[model samples]
Target: MQTQPISTIAFTVFLLLFSPPRAAAVRPPPNPLRSSCAQARYPVLCFQTLSNFSNPTAKPLDLAQAAVRASLVRTRALSAYLGTLKAASQGFGPRQRIAVSDCVQQISDSVSELSKTLNELQHLRDGTFQWQMSNVQTWTSTALTNGDTCISGFNAAATTGNVKLELKQRVTDVAMLTSNALYLINRLADSVTGKSRSNSGN
Candidate 1:
């Protein structure tokens, strides 16, 4: 075998020493929206509702905001539907009319509360995060309660009809969406605050 020249050997050694190692293929991070929604009670609903938004790779705060906005959209749609039904049922019997009117009002209130929650969430910051999150939580809870109240109004008045049942179901569905949004918001708040404290500790 022929031996390489000294210069060649030195060059080979230099190449070996300075050559970059083969990089392992890195897996992309899991979809944050899917990961976060997986923690919700209504994971499918949470995912479907929020996935419609523009960004899926958003941070926790952004995801929470998106979820709240989606919830608001749902609540507003439900409120509008209730309003139409209430208007059409103007000549309905006293009990039915009263029930429908109450439902409209309750769903409207829920929409308002959800809108407020969204507003609060939009302004959340690391410094006043906890308090702001608390307000968001309270508003979301109230929105959920309002939805339940809307359904209860129909039940209390013993209102029955295809329209009544449909409205109740729709309101319940919106309320469930709100509930899932609230869960995501709480989780995001905890995650962000915990990470902030951890970084501070270091």
Candidate 2:
């Protein structure tokens, strides 16, 4: 067999050792929100609502925060819409007016609860993980209840008007969003606590 010259062999070895590493195949980061939301009840809505607030590499806590923020926006919008309906209550009959008033109050309560949930989520590091997670879960649950109460007020009253139906429809959507957010928050809480336990074990 013919042997390569020493200089040629040495140059080839040098190139092999120093040529810029083939850039490791740059993989796009996995979309964390999309993956998590895929398991949500309203997968499409959850993903669409949250994708605007997160990047592909967001962690569970980040995705949970995004979900809370989205729910807050929906609650605030519902509150404002209810306020408008309340303002035009002059045209409503006594029963309809009562329903509108109740809806306005309930929606306002939902806004408050959602706000609290967001605050709790932001301050998760202020307390024990379980305690903070419990507060977030409670507040989100209350917000969902408030949305249901707003819709139920219309249902209980003998109001067959379009306003009642419209308000119910709108609040229903908010309730669904709240429910989805709560699910994400629960998942995040569990994941965070699990990681803490695992690290402590190590």
TM-score of each: 0.80, 0.80
Tens-digit lDDT string for candidate 2 (109-167): 87888888888777777357788788889989998898777677777777786876788
Candidate 1 pairs with clashing backbones: none
Over 4 Å off in model 2, which ranges?
A: 1-30, 200-202
Worst 10 residues of 1 by lDDT: 53-62
Instruction: Give the alpha-carbon lDDT of every model.
Output: 0.84, 0.83
Off by over 4 Å in 1: 1-29
Candidate 2 Cα lDDT to native = 0.83
lDDT score, candidate 1, position 81? 91
